[model samples]
Target: MRQPMIDTYEEAIEAVRACGILPLAPLIPDHPSLSGITLPERWHSDTELDPWRWRVRFPGDGIAAYGKFMKKKAILVASDLVPSVRSLLGSSRSIAQRYGDGLISKAAKEVYAIIEEEQGIETRALRAAAGMKAKESKKEFDQALAELQSGFDIVISGVRAPRNEAGEVNGWNSTCFETVEHWMEGAGIPLAPMSADEARSRLQARLGEHSSPQAMAYFAKVFGF
Candidate 1:
């Protein structure tokens, strides 16, 4: 099938439906190996498809903001496939393993604790609450955040418009973080049902179909697909 042109979120949604999943532009522009326009430049490309609207409109609508194909910041997935992807990643197992292996670094642990306590918070507050504000700690903080997202422990639920110190709107909205369950509850999204092996196999098959042999190999090596 010829992939659709994706200039908008609706188109992006269609693209996700057609391609199964996509890498965010920042990570792999052109989605290198996928069929025609397999990915959009950004999910927040327009007012129609901002994160906040995405939650209200397609909550449970598949689009893994945490991304799976790469360690990059974002990726999109078909809604029905979210649960399967989570299962395939053995997210629950990864979480446990991370804890067991002490993969949850101190910064990550601190951030996780804050999100757990607040249920949901904007990035600015999260950073402050977790004491990730220091410039020197940025790398560690981001790495920890990525680890949590990739493991399906936390997710970007929506965007909270920026506010001035006086509590008035002042800048663009900030992305909000929340636990997977909490985000889903707010978005009215639910995970699709599939066994862990089945989910992994399905995603793997899609990757193979959409990417070149070389790319397929790379994906397997990089993403454990």
Candidate 2:
């Protein structure tokens, strides 16, 4: 079946608002996605209409969040629904609590501390600041980042290239990371505390209305609702 087409930012945002959650790729069942709805030529056009670029812009626009929050895939979640989503699948517990409780790894704690202190940072710089710069730490660093994103402790804010000492661009553009709370605050949204069960019920209700039974079942398992 043909997916509904979306060529511009406005149209895509409208579709996403209607659906609430959109995968960056074509992974979601019975739903529109950024890549799925967009034409292939538009992937990295280096223009305002690029879907690839939109992933970074969307979060800063204060309308939604862009992160690998579900199934370890990039997804854009509606701004208002984030608190609920985090409540259901993410930890509201502090890094200290989660680390102490053995819910997150030592590397995860080290990485998150830098993120919390800096408010946001690039992946390469974050690795350095967290003191995980050794070649062997690459895999563990990545896993820590993924773990934090999966737990909604952090999110990708945007894309940018770091600078060299001489003030020139250092390398290729990299994704920026920020605490979910900071991201929400920057967007003027609050990361309110809530009941996980309540969040699940609300999310299930919303998904049930907009998605199929089969999709709902799939989400229930994937997101652990």
Candidate 3:
């Protein structure tokens, strides 16, 4: 992919939303090579201002954005906004897919979780798939982490969650799981029709624990086990 350029935060936000990806720009120390880049001087002097910290917006229909910051220059991300930006670029393909699988798996394990919680089948399935996808996503995430040859530091805030019409907890609004699920489904992975026994075994194996009671109820409602 080509390096994306933006003159302002708003432009970056718009671009990421359009592409169904999050935009992250963390601030780091100014390098000798960055002497001529046109950025605010305070970005170099202000401890609170991380030039590497960038705004991350989900695709259209998402509710919130995530802001990520790194102390070091990212190597995987390629951008003039910050040297070593190349290292910070991470993809959610596998993680998202894993989450989708997990959601389905968990729902199958405890059908009651879905029933009591009134959670939708699509929602539970997606979460499970994301967990499964993370296994692969982490591999790529690690690669991005290692590619950073030099800089300050890195911190992943958390997954971005969106809100419903009443401001209640809704589905994930980020591309992390969504992107992975899209690919998995496109590749012909079945995320539905999982059985309780199968779901429980897979959930226990993957999570190292049994499914939660609430999760079970939600699954019951969605999967009808």
The segments of candidate 3 whose C-alpha lies over 4 angstroms from its true place after superposition are 1-29, 32-54, 58-127, 130-167, 170-225
**TM-score list, all predictions:** 0.72, 0.93, 0.21
Point out the higher-scoring one by TM-score: 2 or 3: 2
In model 2, the worst 10-residue window by lDDT is 206-215
RMSD of each: 4.5, 1.8, 19.1
- TM-score-wise, the better of 1 and 3 is 1
What do the candidate models score in CA lDDT, each in turn?
Answer: 0.60, 0.83, 0.31
Model 1 CA deviation exceeding 4 Å by range:
26-69, 93-97, 186-194, 205-219, 222-225
Q: How far is candidate 1 from the true structure (C-alpha RMSD, Å)?
A: 4.5
**lDDT tens readout by residue for model 1, 1-225:** 345555455765665665555554434433431223533343445576443345323334434444332465466655555666666543555344567688677777678778878875888888888777899978887887787777677776666788878999998777777777666555556654567667667778776666556556655665466
- Candidate 1 TM-score versus the reference: 0.72
Per-residue lDDT, model 1, residue 98, is: 68
What is the alpha-carbon lDDT of model 3 when measured against the actual structure? 0.31
Writing each residue's lDDT as its tens digit, candidate 2 over 1-21 gives 234788888888777776778
lDDT of 3 by residue, 152-217 (tens): 122222234566789887874432222212322333434344444554444333222233445344
